[model samples]
Target: MGPSTIPAAVDAAAERFGDTEAVVDGEVRLTYRDLRTRVRQVAAAFAAAGLKTGDRVAICAPNTWHWVVAALGASYAGGILVPLNTRFTAAEMQDVISRSDAAALVVATDFLGRNRLAELEELGGVPEFVLTIEDWAFTDEVDAAPVRADDISDILFTSGTTGRSKGAMSAHRQALAVAAAWADCGAVVTGDRYLVINPFFHSFGYKAGILVCLLTGATLVPQAVFDVARTIELVEQERITILPGPPTIYQTLLAQPGCDTLRLAVTGAAPVPVTLAERMQKRFGTVLTAYGLTEAVVATMCRPDDDAETVSHTSGRATADFEVKIADTGEILLRGPNVMIGYLDDAAATAEAIDADGWLHTGDVGVLDERGYLTITDRLKDMYVSGGFNVYPAEVEQALARLDGVTESAVIGIPDDRMGEVGKAFVVSTRLLSTEDVIEHCRVLLANFKVPRQVEFRAALPRNASGKVLKVVLRKESP
Candidate 1:
C-alpha cells in the first residue's frame, strides 16, 4: 500500500511527535498533539454544521493557524478543499466560488486591513453558514468520514494568466505524492522549522508548504506577508531551517543586512539568476530550484548536493516517481502520480491540457540535457517570431536582469511594422535608467533580433499572487 492520505499522515505524525511544536504564528504556538486535537474539533464542527462528503468548502484567508485548521477540517469531513486567493478581488472570488459550487465558506473577518467577510457579503452568493476562526466550536460527538485515496482533495485555481482561471482538481493520492516528492527532494526532516511565506492559495504553499511539513513532522511558521525586516527577525528568532519563495524573496534577503542562518532555501515560479543562486548558497546551507505548475504541485527540483551552476541554470531532473519528456516542439510533458485528476467542471479544457496517453502537456518550452537537467526556455505562448527569428521573452528578461541596477524586468512581444513583431521590455530599477541604457545593455548580450526594440520603466512589474510576472497584463498595458 502507498502512503496514507493527508489527514492520516497528520494523524500519524501527531502520534509520533506528540508534545513537539507543530505550528507557530505571531503569538500562537501549537504542539502536534494540540494541532491534531484542534483539527479534529474543527472537523467535528464542520460536520455538526451539516457539511457532507464530496461537498466543496472554500477558504479565503491569509497564512495563519486558522487557515491550516480549516483546510484539514474540511478534508477530514470528506469535503473537497477549495483555497481562494486572498489577493483576489470580490468579482474574482465570486466567480470561483460560484463555479466550484462551494457549500460553505470559512474566511477571516479581517486580514491585511481588508474585511473578507464584508467582501463576500457584498458579492452576496455566500453559502448559508459562514464561520470565522474565532467562532469555530469544538465538539467530540462528530466522527470524520473515511477518505479514499482517489477522492478529490483540493481544487486549486490557476493564476488566470491566459484567461478565466481553471480549478485544477487534485486527488488525495496526488497530494500525498507531491508531499513525499517535496520532502525527498528538499530534504525536509522532523524537527526542522519551515517558514511558509508563500500564500496558502498557491500549490507551492499549501501542498509543498503545509503538507510537506505535516508529512515530515517539521514545525510550520506561517508568514502572512513578505516583509523583509520582519522575515529576517523571524529567521533569527525561530531558527528557520526551510525557507522557500520566488527568486525575488532571496534577492531581497540577500540585499538585507544581518539576514543569514537559513539552512535550506527553495526558489521557483521564475527564472533564478546565477548570481542569486551563488549568493544563497554562500549564505544558506543548501539551495534548490524547483519547477511545477498548478496542475502538478512539484514536478522537478534540484537536489541539495547540486552545484551552484546546475542549481541556477536548470530546474534539475524530474522527481523520482515522475516521467518528464521534452516534446519535439520543445514543449515539456510530464506523466506521474502527482498529475492532477483534471480541471474542475471543464472536461474540454482538461482534455486539452492532458493527452489520452496521460501526458500533461505543459505549455512551457524546455530542453533536457544529457544529464537529465531540464532548462526552461520560455512559455510557448510567450514566444514570438521577429523577422523569422524566434524570440523568447524569458531569455530577454534574463539578459535584462543581468544589467546593473535592474531589480526586476519583464519582456513581451509587440507589433512592429518592419519585423512583424518585436520584443518590448519593462524594467524596475533602483537607480535612474533610460531606455537607451537598457537597449545598450541588451546590445552586448542579446542578438539584434532578440534585443528589445522599446523599453518602459516602471516602479514594479505587475505580478500574480504566485510571483509570476503577468505578461498578459503587461501586453495589454504596452502600446
Candidate 2:
C-alpha cells in the first residue's frame, strides 16, 4: 500500500521519483528530493516557532512555489491548513482568521503592492506565530509529524446561504484519496507537466492540483495569475501536458495562437457548450469534465476515453468511490469516503448538510441517467460562479447593507461573454444613489470578484408571501 498521510506521501514521492523534476517556478526548479528537503526545512522553522500538533495554520498568498512549500510544511508540522483567499480585504481576512481560530499565519507581503502582514496586524488579526513568505530564516530540518488517516487535515471555508462562510473539514486520507481519484479520471501520470491556473486557496487547486502532482510525480508549474499570453508561453516553455480550469480558461486559450503541446484539458466551474468540448478535443488529445465542491474534493469525472457528448452533456459518472443519488427535491446526494467529515465546529449545520443516513446534500440539482452519469441542471442555492469563484448573493447583499442610504438590496447573477456570470445588484436606497456609489462601497469590503459589476435602482425589492426577497424574480429581470 502507498502512503495515506500527505507528509508520508511527500517522502514517498522523493524516494520513488528522486531525480524527476517536481516544481517549475520562475528561475527556481526542484527535483522531488530537493522539494522534499525544502519542505522539511520550512517544517523545522514552523516547529521552532511553536506550531503544535493539530494547530490551525492559515496561509494567505498567491499561487507560487512559496505557497506549495508553506502549505506542505504546515502539514508536515501537523497543522490543520486554513487557506485564505488572497483577493480578500484585510477585514474579510480577519473574519476567517478569527472564525478558524488559527494559531499561526503565513502571508505574502509583495503581492499586488500591499503589505498584507502589516494590514492584518493593523486590523488586529495577526495570530501567534506570523511569518512572511519572502523571508524564512530557519534552515534546520525536522522530522515530519506522525499524522493519522482519520486526523483532520484542512478546514476550507465556503460561503453559506445565510451570509456567513462555513469551514468544511476533511481528513488526511480523504484528501489523498480524492486527489488520486481525480488523477485517475483525468489520466494524469508521471512525467506530465501540469500548469495549475486555479488558485491555491480553493480545493480544485489545493487538493486536486497540488495533491495530484504529489501522488502522480507530475511536475507542478504554478501560475500566480491567469494571463492568456503567459499561460501559452509556459505551455511551450515548460512543455506542459495537463491544464485544468473553468470553461472560461479554455475559451480564452482556444482563441490564442495554437499550442498543440497540451495533452489533457479538465474543466467545469460553469456550463460548457458541446462546441467548446469538441474544439478542446481537437486542440488537446483528451478532455474531461468534473463536478465537486469544497465539501467533496472530486465527486464525479469523465474518463479519457469518453466521447465529447458524454464529456460535455454530463459531469460523467461518479469517481472517488462515491455513491451518487438524487433526493426527492432533486438535490444531488453523495455518500463516500471523500465526503467531508463535517463543517468546522458547527454540529447543527453539519447535521443539516449531511442527513442521518450519511448522504451529503449537494444543494445542486442534477439528474442521473441509466448509465449513472450525472448532469448538473441548476443550483438550488442562490450561489453563482463568477470567473470560476463562487459568488453568494446573500454575502454580497450583506456587504451592500453596510453602505449608506442602502435600505434593501437583492443580488443576482447575469450571464456574460467573458466571465461565465457577473453580479447584478438591485438596490432600494433612501436617497438618490449612482451605480458607481454602490459598487465603490462594496470594493472596500469584498473581493474584486464579489463586487457587483452592474447596479440598478428600484423603489422596493420584490418580495414573496414570507416577506423574503424574490431573488428568482430579480434574476429573471437581470441585466
Candidate with the greatest TM-score versus the true structure: 2
The positional error of residue 420 in candidate 2, measured at the CA in angstroms, is 1.3
Q: Go through the candidates in order and give each one's C-alpha lDDT.
A: 0.83, 0.90
Error of 2 at 426 (Å): 0.6
Residues 106-178 of candidate 1: C-alpha lDDT, one tens digit per residue: 9988777778789778979988768786576676734457888899999998633343668999998889888
For every model in order, what is the number of clashing pairs? 0, 0
Once fitted onto the true fold, the runs of candidate 1 whose alpha carbons sit more than 4 angstroms away are 137-141, 159-162, 255-260, 382-479
Q: What is the TM-score of each candidate against the true structure?
A: 0.80, 0.98
**1-479, model 2: which lDDT tens digit per residue?**
66889899999999999999999999989999998998999899889988888999999999999899999999999999999999998988999999999999989998988788888889885898987888866669999998998999999999888878899999999999999998888788899999999999999999999999999999999999888789889988998899987787788789877667799999887778889999999888899988888999789889898888898899989899999999889999999988999999899999999999999998999999999999999889988889888899999999999998999998988898777889999999999899999999999989999999999999998998999998888887765
Q: What TM-score does prediction 2 earn?
A: 0.98
